[model samples]
Target chain A: MRLLEALALTITNGSKPVCRNQNFHLQAGEIWGVLGPNGIGKTSLLHTLAGLRKPLSGQITLMDKPLASYDRKQLATQLGIVFQDSQDTFPSTVLETVLMGRHPYLSEWAWESVEDISLCMTALEQVALATLAQRQVNTLSGGERRRLALAILLVQNPSICLLDEPTNHLDLHHQMVLLELIVQKTLRNNGGVVMVLQDVNLVPRFCTHVLLMHNADSWISGPVADVMTTTNLQLLYQHSIRKLVDNGVTLFYPE
Target chain B: MPVFSPAVPVLSGRYFLVLFFVALFAALSFVVALGLGSADISFNDIVAVLTGTSDSLNQQIILQIRLPRVQTGMCVGGMLAMAGCLMQILLRNPLAEPYVLGVSGGAAVFALLAIVSGLSGLWINGSAFAGALLSIFLVFVLSRIGNDWNPLRILLTGVVISAGWSAFISFLLAVSPPDQLHGMLFWLMGDLSYVQSSFWNPIVLAVVLLPSLVYARSMNLLATGDLNAAALGVNVTRLQYFIYFASSLLTATAVMQGGSIGFIGLVVPHLVRILFGSDHRILLPVSVMLGGSLLVIADGLARSLIAPEQLPVGVLTAMLGVPLFLVLLQTILFRQRT
Candidate 1:
């Protein structure tokens, strides 16, 4: 089933329509990457697709229903989003923070069951944060905080995951591990994953599909094999590009 | 993964333990406060009066004066603290208190007007409530810039409106008759002596707190960030409205009862957060118990410290809470540094 479908979607910055008449769709077993320069509405487009912001003129359907039709909790059961930046103004333990992902599934005022706690613990373990379950979130390092956010998204266990810059502050080891984890989960469940990424090289390696937004209004999107060629890369990023193909791996460098 | 996991659940056991201990402490504080007033009532007499086995001077003093005063303190303190917690969550601002959003100031303005106009009894309470609701509505409308419930804007509007209310309050006080000045000043400074004997305050506290407690999970999510809460499926806009109106109701009720007891509302939630962590599931109830108990104890000291020349409960709350708050702040800073 198509997990997300956008038709003629035009997202705007205030009254000025930035990305106009854009069409995209994501089905199960596909991992899509969104790439764009800074201030080009990539975050806004991700937000609009996740039903957090309204599209200027478009129709978006999630799970075959209009996006606006699904209520917040109902939509949350199917779609989970990990924000690029999260702040903890108040102190809550890591376990407590991860357990909040179970909120959409639980009834109001209901206590989390043992199963919920176990799921959270398992996600924490997956992110190597089980040892810090009782530690305060504010006390965590930047990479740990990012992993904690990913752990929260994992616990939500949604059918479609939307991540804005899933890796921003992680070391190379954590970056590879986290992306591998996300890909593993999506492939295992035959679920869809859409992420906004700044690392263009990472896209050709990991993404099954790619959407390159150009300045806001124009771009190209298709299977990664077609959309990630040298000419398309130059047009989307507006830079001279050097492509190196070695041992079935492709690398892009600006000249 | 080698950490030894306790058999008890993470949230439930510690929550109940805190609730049980604070409840016990509140009961103990209530009894001690009942015994400390000027009319020398022994513990035995208090017990007898409580058990309904005595009807004399001691029983009269306990039933008529001390009991009513303690009850008022509990309701006012609990509601104020609860309001403060809601405001802190709603604005995502640690320094938010019930009065920080202009609730108490608005209530004070209307209440002072009532006093100056020779109004007493329910008339004062009615207008104070009106003023409170008005301030809440004004802040709500003013802060709704482009359908965005910007926390900073709401905070700024409330603070500015409160400043406006303060000006009006000062103007009222400046022109009042000398005889009415004392009563108006007492009201402004938060005196519980004016609370009439009634069971309504406690009942109202329960009515408001029940709904607020149900939103504990949402409040915890909200404390993280609005985007985080919305992404987690909490209807952030609707929840913000729920918290704002519910907290305004609580603040109006508390201000009507105790004339804006200041320190408990501002400091108790932080103290509770520091001790119990920031989970509202545990923080909310603990704050109520601690806030109520602290105010009752403060009121007791206020009544007895000068021997019939009672001090305003607000003055006592600040005198007591400021030093503890400073110590807690220092400890937090020290922990952060180390």
Candidate 2:
């Protein structure tokens, strides 16, 4: 099933259009990685896809319906996005922060039920933040905060997950563990995952497909084996790249 | 995977305990305020007067003067605190208060005009309320000049208008006669000596608080950021407007009742947040209760501190709140370090 489709999409960063006339369909049970160098509009593209930003010129549909047709609450049920960074204007507990995921599912005057709390706790444990449920969010480390954001997205349980730099600030072990967890969870629920990643080597291992944003009005996306080549990556980053195979696993490195 | 249970019970227990203490403090302050006036009525006399068993001058004192004054103090304090809480969330600034948006400045200008015109009682209050409404309208309109309603824009607009009102207030003060100057100064300093018992203040408080409590959860999400709250399923635009109007109404009503009393609105919410967590479900009501009680006590001090020459309650609140908040912060920091 198609979870998200962008037709004739043109995303911009408020001053200049970044990617133009892009077309992509994210299907259920597939994880797509968006790779780009610095200053590229990867975050803007993800924001546009999540309906947080207006596409410069394009159409986005979720579950075969126009994205703009649904109200915020309804859209949240079908899609969730983990921003690059979370803001803490006021102090709140870790559990309280995670419980916000259930906001869309719950009514205006309702409190979180036991099942909701259970789901949040399970998500926290999956993210290795179960012990810090009572700790204040402002006291968390950057990596811990990132895990907390992922936990919130997990608890949201939307069909389409749009993550901007999901592995940002995470150590190598947590990066691998959490990404694997997100992929496994998405596949288990037959959901679609699109995450912008900084690590080039992580794509071949976690993403089933790749969307390489070269520059404004230029891009290529296909299965990882098809689009993730030395030439394509070199062109994407405007640098030299070398591809190597170790024990039948493919990896790319900058030369 | 390991299974874990949420800390709901612990949090709920803390909520109940904090609420219970704040409510008790409010009740105690009410009783103490009624008994500690110039006439010095005893606790038993207050109870007797309340129960309609005492027919002495104490009855008249407690029933006629102190009762209305205490009630007014409670209403104004609760309204201001609730307004301040909403303003902080709306502007996403901890320093935001009921008067930060020029409501009080407009009120001060108009109330001074009324005093300069030799108006008393209801006329001054009516003019102040009108001025507050005018301020609200101006800020709302000016902030949306380019159809932008961001917090920074709204805040800047309010501050500018407030400055304009301040200049007008200075002009009014400069030309007023010496006799009317006393009343004008009292108004600016937030005197509550002449407030009468009316149902409107409580009604307004209930009206504003009900919706605020109902939307408290959304407010928690909103305090993060607009995009964050919207992505979390909160109707950010609708909620923002609701906060804007609701807090303005709260500030307007509070200024009308008590001449734009300060400190309670600004400090009470922070005090409550420091004691309890920032969960609005608990924060809103507790702040109201604590604010009402603190103002009631402050008003009592204002009345009896000089025994006959009553000081402005706002002065007392600021004097009291500054030390209290500082000590509380220091103790909390010390505890954390230990």
Candidate 3:
């Protein structure tokens, strides 16, 4: 099933188009990694996809309906996004922060039910943050806060997950663990996952497809094996790149 | 897999228990304030007057004089505290208070003008209320010029307007005659001496309280940030407008009643948050109760402190709230550290 489709999408950063005339279809159980260089509007594209900002031009459809047709609450039920960073402007418990995932499902003036809380706890456990559920969110370390954000997305349980730099601030072990968990959960629920990633090597291991944003009005995308060649990566980053194979696993690095 | 339990009870029995105690304290403060006037009426007489059994001069004193004053204080205090709580959430700043938006300043400027023009009674309150509405309108229009209702923009606009009002207030004070100075100063300091018991106070409280309680959960989500709240499925623009209008109305009503009683709005919410957590479901109602009770007690002290020479209730609230808040903060911090 097609979970998300972008037709001739033009994403922008206020005035200028970041990427123009992009077309893509995200299907169930497919994890698409958006790879780009620094300051290339990856986050802006993600924000546009999540309906948090207006795309410069073009249309986005979620679940075969126009994205603009859905109100914020309705959109939240069908899609979720984990921002690159979260700001802690007020004091709140870790559990309370994660339980905000249930916000769209709850009616006005209703409190979280037992099942809602159980889901939050399970998500926290998945992120290794169950023990800190009662701790204040402001006191958390950078990596811990990142995990908390992931936990919130997990609890939201949307069919289409749009993550901006999901591996940011995580250590090596946690980076692998969390990416695997997200892929497994998406496959289990037959959902689609699109994550903006900084690590080039992570894309081949975890993503079935990759969207390489070369520059404004230029792009390439296909299965990881086809589009993740050293030549394509070198063109994408405007640098020389080399490829190697170790124990049948493909890897690319800057030469 | 490990079994998991809730870290904190979202809306549990303990919160209700705390609310019950705060309500009980408010009731006790009301009774105590009713009984502690120049002519010391006994507790029995106070209860008798309240229950419609007493018919003496004591009954007249209780019904005619103290009841209205205490009732006005409670209503004004509750309104201010709730406004403060809303402002804090609306601005997403812990330092926000009801008057931070210049509502009270506008009210004060017009109130001082009314006093200088030889106006008394409802004239001062009416002008003050009009001034407050004007300020609310000004902030609302100015902050929304670009249709960007961001918190920082709203806060900056309010602060600048408040500064302008202060200049006008100083100019008025500078020009007013000596004979009117006493009343002008008293009004500026937030005196409740002349406030009569009106049905509008309770009515306004109910009108504001119900809608705010309904939106309390959205308030929690909003405190994170506007975009984050939007991502969490809240209608950010609508909620911001609601908070701006509701809190402004609350401040206007409070200023009309008691001349912008300070500290209660700013301190009472913090007091409640320190005792309870920052859950708006509990924070809003609890802040109202505590604020009302504290103001009633402060008004009682203001009345009896000099026995016929009443200090402005605002003065007493600052004097009382500062030390109490500091002590609570110190205790909580020490406990957390240990």
Cα lDDT computed for each candidate against the true fold: 0.86, 0.88, 0.88
Can you write out model 2's per-residue Cα lDDT over A109-221, one digit (the tens) per residue? 77788788899999999999999997778889999999999999999988889999988899999999999998898888889999999999999999999999987778899
Candidate with the greatest DockQ versus the true structure: 1
lDDT of model 2 at residue A38?
Answer: 83
Alpha-carbon runs more than 4 Å astray in model 3? B1-7
User: Of models 2 and 3, which has the larger DockQ?
Assistant: 3
Candidate 1 residue-wise lDDT, B1-338, digit = tens: 10122333355765677789889999998998899877777788889999999868888899888998898788788888888899999889888999998988899999999988999978888888888888988998889867777788999999999999999999998998999998888888888886766687878778867877788888889898888888888888888888888889889888887887888988999888777677787778878888899899999988988977899989999999999889977877776676
Model 1: per-residue lDDT, tens digit, A1-255? Answer: 899999998889886566888888999999999998888888898899989888878899997899999988888888999999898777777898899999999887788888899999999999999998877788899999999999999989888999999888988888889889988888898799999999888898789999998855576888999889889888877899989999998999999
In model 2, which regions exceed 4 Å deviation?
A: B1-18
Error of 2 at B314 (Å): 0.5
Distance from true location, Cα of A238 in model 2, Å: 1.4
DockQ of each: 0.59, 0.56, 0.57
True C-alpha contacts between chains kept, each model in order: 0.62, 0.65, 0.64
Q: For each candidate, what is chain B's TM-score?
A: 0.94, 0.95, 0.96
What are the runs in model 1 whose C-alpha is more than 4 Å off? B1-9, B329-338
Report the lDDT tens digits of candidate 2 across residue range B1-338: 00122356224555577678778889999999887667777889888988889977988888889999999898889989999999999999999999999999999898888888888899999999999999999999999887558999999999999999999999998998888888888888888899999999889988888888889989999998988888988888899999999989989988987896888988998888777767788889988888898898999999999988899999999999999999877876675565
TM-score of chain A of 1: 0.97
